[model samples]
Target: MGLGKLLHDHAEHADVGGTIDHPRAYELAAEIGFLGRRREIFTRLAALSGVRPGDRVLDVGCGTGYLTRILAPIVSPAGRVTGVDASAPMVEHARRRAPGNCSYQVGEGQALDLPDAGFDVVVSSLAVHHIPAAERGAALREMFRVLRPGGRLLIAEFRPPTNHLLAQLVGMVSGPAMRHSPHDLLGDLIPAAGFHVQDEGDLPVMLSYVRALRPST
Candidate 1:
């Protein structure tokens, strides 16, 4: 379908949930690049997650596969990288741009249908905030479920809004669900998801990254 149809489809679902589908998804991709945070955020996430040459990685909510592309080379010849998004259009778009070693699938963060204990690392960038407040915990638990014991999970998200005005603005642009995201409560959320917190810190423009691990038991 044409971009028009793609965008129309996105609009149909925009308010139903917090999805950046089609044209807006593409627009956000460009906007992040313009701010120079696109590359920086994913790079830092990769580093913080410590993805190695042979690690099997999953990029949850991997809209259009930008970060999946970045990870393909890092995992290199032996490793595999899979990118999954709830938006089928985004998954299709991502597949077009993905490398040979990278794969794209249609999936949801709150209930991934992937095999359990399969990936060595899972990274989600600025995506989970789109999940409704009530569903965010289930999403984190799914991320935990997909990782192998001792595997790593890294997430990059906007920090909690600094003021009521900013908070309101975030809700308008991102969604109401974002206000209740793990941004401010990572210390607790990560552990509740059955992860051991490894590191947490700020990124550019009110964004933050968290690194956690599934216990090796």
Candidate 2:
């Protein structure tokens, strides 16, 4: 795969925008040492998501289904978990790795093929930033639309370093597509999407976790 694939050129294609193929995606994961922390990160995201038994959950931008696998058993027996990503290769790999309760789809954050108010909890980790910064708000609204009344929304994003040097280093390693600056934007976008911001703080390492909820009607 080319560098553009890993960087995710959002302009070339409108709907399914990401370009990270299986090899490059996994290679990046290994390069960042994210593979080791994958389980821990997924656990934190799932806990913050407040996923309960029998709840329907959606994992947006569920690259390789690492988080989706962690979520399946939590909402098992009667619950269902669906993982979606813009990269077909990622989706394919995730499907191969998925459990009985989990499924994968090729989709984008800004426009999901799911129905309105269908999920009890919607979560994405280190994924939303792949969407173009200009269209992030729309993607947040899309997350909101799929969530049922009183459903939870949890997103795990990079906690940008306060130090300029470290920040630039992080940007360089994570790529230009990571310029969405989740910490700065999600605080506002979640509420604007009609979700009530419930909790926000650091997860482990460089990640920041935000938990929100759709108001019950």
Candidate 3:
């Protein structure tokens, strides 16, 4: 089976909980209200993204289309939101739930099929971490290539824990995820990808939202 198919199997009933056909994300993030913390994070991204009504947006690892659907309205009528994930089941769920303004496809994060500089904004929430540690920097590079000058890339990833309690808890719940933690300097890696890292910080405190912007000339 291809990687996509393998991913599909692992994701069976893996998503949060709602869609009977599609698996739920372990985060159970969609359970939150549309105007809740997610909205707040995206609002900040919108401002930093320079995502006007007519700019194209790319959603990397857009599971179940939560953030993708949210971005559609903001960039609608003129702009479009494209969601890409490797899991067929996840893509199906996203397609069913997504409005016509959005499109979902089964694809890999490191090797996006989209053309260069095609998007004005590139965003991923709690998704980039799934990529293998060695290729995450390449994934960011791909995002950079697809983003137009001044396009924005916002990623919310799990940061290294400060205490053993949080670490232990993370190990228990997301231990498998630990393999993807490369310990790379995300602050500097964003810049190394050809885009200056405009902002680097933890967001929502508990969620560890890491955000960066690439300015266009």
Best by lDDT: 2
TM-score of 1: 0.82
Candidate 3: tens digits of C-alpha lDDT, residues 1-217: 4322333334322221111123564324233312257667656655555567977899888877877777778887788999998777888889889888899898877899989999888987667656654666788899999998877887766565667676665544443333233234244556778776665556552344445667666
Which lDDT value does model 2 have at 14? 26
Q: Whose lDDT is higher: candidate 1's or candidate 2's?
A: 2
Better of 1 and 3 by TM-score: 1
- Which residue runs does candidate 3 get wrong by more than 4 Å? 1-22, 25-48, 160-163, 178-187, 213-217
Model 3 clash pairs are 14-24, 15-23, 15-24, 15-25, 16-24, 16-25, 149-216, 150-215, 150-216
Ranking by TM-score: 2, 1, 3
Best TM-score among the predictions, by candidate number: 2
lDDT of 1 by residue, 1-217 (tens): 5432343343333224455577355656346432766677667677787999999999988988878888889999899999888888788888888799999888778989899999999999877755655677888899999999999999887666678886775545444334544545343667899999887888765677888899999
lDDT of 2 by residue, 76-126 (tens): 869999998988988888888889999889988999999999999999887
lDDT of 1 at 157: 75
Query: What TM-score against the true fold does each predicted structure earn?
Result: 0.82, 0.85, 0.75
Clashes of each: 0, 0, 9
